[model samples]
Target: MKPLCLSLLIPAVLFAGATVYNAPAGVEQDKLFQVKVAGQPSFVYSLPVGGMTYFSYTSFARRADIEITVARPVETVAIRPTSYGIRPVINGNVITFRLDRTAQISVEINGDIKHPLLLFANPPESAPPKPGPSGIHYFGAGQVHNVGRITVTSGQLVYIAGGAIVRGSIFMDQARGVHILGRGVLDGSLYKKGESRMIEVNRSSDVDIEGIIVTNSKHWTVPITASDKVTLHNVKLVSDNDWDDGVDVVGSTNVTVDQCFIRTKDDCVAVKAGVQYFTKFNAQRDVSNVVIKRSVLWNGAWGNGLEIGFETRAASIRGVRFLDNDLIHVEGPEGTFSIHNGDRAVISDVIYDNCRVEDSKGLLVDFKILKSRYSKDAERGQIRNIVFRRIRVDQAEMPSILQGFDATHQVGGVVFEDVKTGGRKWTSLADAGIKATHTENVSFK
Candidate 1:
């Protein structure tokens, strides 16, 4: 697939320190679109249309009315998957829309569904401060601050103000009471893959990251490892490289990810019990009490929409919840709700409630306790007490799967209540087209 060739006609809109980006020369354009939020300009990139089964760069907006201007005469404009309930009012080439919360929307012009624009609208932040030393490391607006590999210590607050593009990554290790707050862009374009993450919280606690836009990460965008009481709110992460996950919570507890927009080339959000990279600190920890609510997850080349444990080295992982979220687009062989517990951990007490899956090229649900290539232990894990309540799939190509490793490690206590596919209620395992093997106490209500 090739990128669309277009041009930006408008100059940069500068208002109160916010600057919208103009597409540079020699860069190809797609539809020549421009996005503005609260009279401030945002940078839009021209990405390949549906290249590697994922959409292009996603633009962001605050809670105000958003205006999108495409450089073409539109015959018709519509937002897809229909579940977002966004009614865009079109006047010529400009389309106007507003969102009450965060959303991942595909804007189609003239019925060109393959080259649709990806837009994400986020809620505004309350009580944003000026660039001053209130115990905050503030980056002022309209300037490209090049700080490489910022190491945040304990009781530090890093604030990147609006319109400021900070070109670096943040590393927080063994820190406490850390806060990363702002409406700025943290670009990891200068770093190499596996060199750094956009925001890495390792062995930290009581950390808060809110109202930021992270782009062009070389590795996993935001990886929280061995952390507790971590809260990520109103954050937007967009990446176009391999292994660029939206957020990977590994061996963490009491974590909450709310109202965020994540578009990555890998898993949108993955909960794992110690992978190979962070084996030292995470090998003995379990992931528990995690909640991801009211967010948008879009996968690019590979991986699941919301996944758990392909590298299970801990003892147990439980009490995970995915509530009131949207799985907009998932490609490849993974499912919208997937659990590949390949290690010796006992995984249970997980729930997927009120999730609306728009279009998945893989399975709707996939739960398996098998030994994969990433597994270290010969003994497989047990999976039980899992529930999927009120999950609606608009389009799916494959059926669900629930399989155990062997007779010793079985899957039990799985239930699906009021699950729907293509607007039809699923009353039984056969009605939902699920393949169950070596499982017991599986019910559909």
Candidate 2:
């Protein structure tokens, strides 16, 4: 429990196939963690979380070693999303680990959850956007811009260069083929509660958002509603506030959220079929074909990690997939993977495949067809054909339930396949402590 004071300077080594970005001018560095990737300084941005949380990101074509110098002597070192099994070599105040592929992990020194450091080892990006366009809005590096609520339309590219910080929100309505790219930071701390969403996509199509850090979102971080063909790739959202849901795919279709890091106060990723979306346009009310894959998520104190509805007002909500993601910390009152079908929707064909949980304080699975504060229909709904495959948990023994309002609004055709909790593979329903009252064909395989 003693603080270790060491020189901040370490000889920089130019390791092949690695790129470490420096902090922008006037951006404060993390006092607790000085991270070096491939022997180069990876600027760790410190933010006030529970007390403080540090974040550092680097890109690698193949592999790299991450070295961290801590301010305090560590008794225990835990690198989590424990399904990765990343065991670090700790020597005094230095911790070292190797990453072979793209990963986002929490480094907890002596099991300190409140002050953990988040490391994002990312894959190499595609070629930078070619410099030739009329619809290009660029913010250069080492600068801070205050552009509040920038609007975009068709065939536009909004690029935020590395080491740039922008205090604004990207609002797109009735847009098509718009891309918001590059490695920068979008800080929304200036926006008060209910003022704005960091990236608001309403009535848009063919939109792509890639490689940016969204911090302190006033409302939902990225809310996609009445949109189609949208993709969110390698975006990091680190904002914990009231009602600050990470990625709310509401009434959207053909959307893919890939390889993102979301540590927020509300649901990390939620799918729904009802929302008012924006001011001018009429919103879509049926949701389908949404995929969220290969992301690292943490839900803090408010909602679920991966959730569907309570706002399921549409007639059909189907074809939603959550694949190969990691939920590191889910501390909420609801289920980590839940379906709260409050309205009159037939929610079906949902799949959670190869998901991992490092530390969870919520239900593993909850599929209920009932009413809540967000419901609109007087009659209840049903959940059908839900599959949870290869789920791995490394923490507390969470409970699960599949109940309904009555026999008319029951849960049906659910399968729990290859789920392991605390190193024990579930062979029976008792191993997972699931209660299926009005459920049908619930099986463990």
Candidate 3:
């Protein structure tokens, strides 16, 4: 399916005798456009917005058209590298406009396509940035006595030194190449209602959040969404609020979460494809290639170490590895480390290696086959190629519950090698290790 593109329409105030202009030479041939004002070709699609004109592009299927709202004057609007071939024909067409690397092209509207106009056929800018300290300059909604929230755009680098205490969620929504470094402390204990997050990095790339302490957030504490090449290293998340989750990664890829310490009331680290309520477009959401290694989880009496999928479908989580992590006092139902595939998705190729656990009262590992038995979106499939190596658990009150729904939608190819448990004799390894049923290819070596 073609991604959705917004065709910005010029407001009705700037319709002077506007001029028509065409693109310059050397523009990409694949991307094309046609600009109109009052239903006239007042400006070429390749021309920059010198004034108020409506802009339309392929939304989906190369034929569907969409328009958005824009505000820019003609004189200040300049379209560099102005020419290209005719626009493609498709429906719900969503073209990616990356900065820097993408050749310069301009769109003519009666107005500008806003500040961050989408560049058709251009790749995101990958300019070789100068070397400097890599971190986030946080402007969250908090108080030094009320030093308001900080907003940093994508591709900007700000270093946070150690021992700096700030109150609020650092907004990294539109930022790229963000780095949170040093022994910094982002205190989010007093977050207000309707705030986005303690540290939210969304739609960005090459981000690194490391060696920081995020404490006392009121909501999802540190969430990275729709981003890529992110690293969370040696970070400590202390959530005192009821809804404070440590890390919620949604629609992201190539993330490495290592050597972190978490004590929260919710799941310490949840690898999610996307949430159902907020995300509607399947093309805009996906998460993959994540690794959580050598971390410690604690204090959540009902929290999960690693959980996947909540509500929405269209998820395909692959190449995820959780290795050398330590879990302490991770409390939840028997099926806490739950892999839930709702519909139109498959959660596969996940591995957990050399993970040490402590004080797990509920089931050690549980994989849910269908979202629910009766839901219609339930495309029954197997949880394939899950491997757990050298997982040592200590002190569980009940039996570990690991099961699949049926033979067809069973937990496929679960390899549990060198798995040992220590507990009281009544609920020991022989009795409480695994209570699996309706599974296939489950072997312990």
Candidate 4:
């Protein structure tokens, strides 16, 4: 995909407009198209090659009208998560649409997935916190701060204001009651891959991270290991490098991720037990009570959309829920709802409720308990008591796999209720593009 000329950004830099918020002043803009929101200019961020441009705004649930003029001739336009049923009107190289509520959608022009535009419409933030509080670290708007690493302790707060860009990674190790709240950007573009994770929480408790954009992570975007009672809301993750998973909850409990947008080359969100972190931190605990709901995910070529593991060395991984998440795009060799248990954990009580898949070039569902290269245990694991309810797939072209290691280590007690693929309700494994092997008690309702 050819990048548009950068000269179009010269006029955009001087515009006085009704922006949703102040953007970082020095970042490069995507000039493939000119965007206007409510008759004012809105900036679209240009990422590296093979990545897409993204524009985000806050609307407070009010109707927002957006206009985009393409730099080239337009033939067709499509908006997704098709579940939203948004149809735009295009006139001469220009596109227009209205959104009544908050959504994260992809605007694909001329059916070009390679150069699509990701539009993130956000809800209004209620009472954004300010500076000068005790134990509070605040970075102001529109400035680029070159802080490399932020080591947060217990009972601390790090607030990144909108338009502020912090070139750093945050680590909360062996801490409690830490809050990382912001609308600003946490950029890891300066670091090489494997150098840092954008935000890492190890052996922490009672943590709240919300409304921040973590982009270009050197490694995993956010990895919560051996943590408890963590909440991540309205977060946006954008990274396309290898191993740049959006969020990984390894051996964590009582974690809730709500209303976020994640686009990555690796898994959008993954759950694991006893998985080794990059450092020698806490890696000994069960994975339970992890909930990911009301989020938007775009998985690139390397990993699953919502995965359980290829690393489960703990005793069990239980009570994980995926509710009302829209997987907008998944391009992979992995499945959309996958549980790849390679270790000795007895993974159970997992459910996917009201999940929708818009476009997937891979399998729709995959549950396998087999050893892979990521396995660390001598004994294989099992997957049981899993449910998929009200899952609707719009476009999926691959067959799902349900396989177990052997007779003793199996995948059992699985049920799919009210599941639909390609606009057809399925009651059989073949109808849902599923193939089972060495499994037990799998049924559709």
Candidate 5:
């Protein structure tokens, strides 16, 4: 097979914070392609062909109308995984597409899987909200702000501009009323393993994080621990390393995570009552009232698409909700929706509603209250009152598993309503290919 070859050409624009890249010199100039979004030129980079059998990369634009002009004429062009239902208007080699909202999608040329374009449509940039009477730390666009480790104080605002790249990590410890807002990029590529998370909020209250793209994180992309009333909105995280979870909420209450896009190598989103980092702070308190909704999650490796607890240590975790989300790809043994309650926390009142899972290489759903090697506690947790409603899966290879450790700590009061697989309504547990072991009060509708 011939080596896949493609070139990109980005026009120079006057946008202050737009990303820019220089094409390599060896490729034919005629093979170059240009992409324009919302009248502004965006920086496009080739995604590395990793262990996967394809080539892709990350690109960003703030505009809804995207125009791509490829150098060579194409016989056929289509978007892969077809579940996204994106159709581009092909005029010769020039393609025009419109996006109503921001998304991460792949573009294939001539039915070729060897080389494809992974495009990330970012939301339009707005002026960073004023810091108000409180202090404001701002980083404008078209610049690289090297902040090794930033710690925000109470009642402060840290704003990153749309084109600016903040190379470092952000920390909020023991703070209240902190706001982190931007359309910019927080890049953790420079951070080594175990250094720090791309963003860490600990012991904070009434915090808000919005409209930021985080890339190449060495550790967890975002970890909010021991924080209450925290809200994350319209944030996008892309990671290619191990343990690079998109967003991890641990030992927190009243947390709302919405309108985000996460493509990572680990769990896209994980909710835990307590972990090693916040065990002391979450000793007696429970994690409750957390909602993750209207987000897109893609797991690269070694994790669940949406998971709750393997290291849970708190007394209880309640009122957790995952709603109106799209799990595009889950590439691990762990299922698309997983609840592995390993510790002593009583996990209850959890709901997964209106979720659309496109592809899961493993199981569709796995819920178990059992002890694992990763658990610090010897006793398993109790999982009850869990509901999966209007959940749809396009493809799943393995059967779902719902098991409890024993009768004492069994999974109970579980219901799957209006669940569908491959356009077939799953009215029974067997139809859903779910294996229930040592569980009680399981119902399907």
Candidate 6:
């Protein structure tokens, strides 16, 4: 969108009259021509942020990857690709770029991004966190001034204190019996609009993230893949950006998310499994034994809490519970608490207990089961054994909806208990909290 300026020069000369013109000199070396969008040329910057190098090209060009390494460890550095006569690719601490032609480039080093890059606020590896008089460590130290990708490897009792800001993904891979305890913080405020992921927990087991504050992440706040026995307690996940979610647990088992505060633009908590035709990573592996309790939600720009199976086919989601949680500021212009098998998975034994609602404009719970588009299991099972008990609502405008789009997959055993009314009541199909068709054995208590 921005206009660019190209340098004017004379022809190269040799032997008074014979011409010997080579490549462009100086900034022209790094200067790339015709790298324009629409009609104007744009500039891409190859810079370092949070201990990581990024090769960013302007005008939405196909990404060029390269690596650059810093000789000395400086507190902060900003690398711009336009100045270096090249586009950069960021790999860890290294940044690599390519010059447009054989030319000279100018590089200017500046201090880090005009702010306090808090490194590590938590305790170091050598020091163990001390417990309180009650034998519980409520908080850990704070870390700042680090950038890019952060890898937290195998260790015991790794505690991160609150107020620690992380600009990249927190990679906890292959860690056994890890505990991220205390009232700490993991801040990813910088990547609030970028393409980087906030946290990635892979191949980890028996891990616990409790009593922490994680905010301003772009994608999922906490993502669990191939992990087992994971627990999230009293953690707060909040973001003001679009596509921000509380937690996304995929292909994980025996996971529990309880006593947490979630506020974002996406699902408060979403669970899923892998399918053969519709899966991304491994296939035919379903998620099980997931529980959510005592949590509070502010609002997701889309929906509040959800269980989606758009990719997973014939995937059975079982033993899931949403207990004693609060859903605040839910907008059901469509519906809230959406759980649809998407014509595939058999979502079974899901329970919602003691859920209090402050204000909602959508259905309290939505479960629509149908045949799988990708699976030949035409006899796909129903959304079975789903129950909602002791749900107290201070306000709501929409009735709960339950509908089986087709006859092959029917809804079964749906119950609503102790439903309390709140807010100014309106009457419409859009106003009922429960709307169902071909839903069987459904009851409201």
* Best by the TM-score measure: 4
Count of residue pairs whose backbone atoms collide, per candidate? 1, 0, 53, 0, 4, 50
lDDT of 5 by residue, 45-140 (tens): 433311111011123433356677776687787763355677889998988886654665656678653345556555544544653444788876
Q: How accurate is candidate 6 locally (lDDT)?
A: 0.53
Write model 6 residue lDDT over 28-138, tens digit each, in one string.
212111122122222221111122101112212232222234443433333321222344454444444543221112222234221111111111122337746432323
Full-model lDDT for every candidate:
0.77, 0.81, 0.54, 0.82, 0.74, 0.53
For model 3 the local lDDT of residue 246 reads 83
- What is candidate 4's lDDT per residue for 1-445, written digit by digit as tens? 1223333222212222223544555667766867777676666777652223323344343566889888879999988877787889999999999877777777888878777777766555567777788888898876678899999999999998766778899998889999898767788988887888889999999999988878887698999999999999988898889899999999989999998989899999999878776858658589889999999999999899999998898999999999999998899878899999988999999999999998887878888988899888999988999999999887644588999889998889999899887777778877777789999998999
Q: How much is the lDDT of residue 310 in candidate 3?
A: 48
Error of 4 at 214 (Å): 1.3
Task: In angstroms, give how far residue 237 of model 2 lies from its true place.
Answer: 0.9
Question: Candidate 4 versus the native: TM-score?
Answer: 0.92
lDDT of 1: 0.77
What is the Cα-based lDDT of residue 167 in candidate 6?
Answer: 39
After the best TM-score superposition of candidate 6, give how far the Cα of residue 1 lies from its true spot, in angstroms. Answer: 28
Q: Write the per-residue lDDT of candidate 3 for residues 175-238, one digit (tens) a residue.
A: 6766665433466645664354777777778887765556567678777777788898767676
Instruction: Put the candidates in TM-score order, highest first.
Output: 4, 2, 1, 5, 3, 6
Q: Distance (Å) between predicted and true CA of 102, model 4?
A: 1.9
Of models 3 and 5, which has the larger lDDT?
A: 5
lDDT of prediction 5: 0.74
- Which residue runs does candidate 1 get wrong by more than 4 Å? 1-31, 36-65, 73-76, 98-104, 110-116, 130-135
TM-score: model 3 vs. ground truth: 0.62
Q: Show where candidate 5 strays beyond 4 Å.
A: 1-33, 38-40, 46-63, 70-84, 91-93, 102-134, 278-284, 396-398
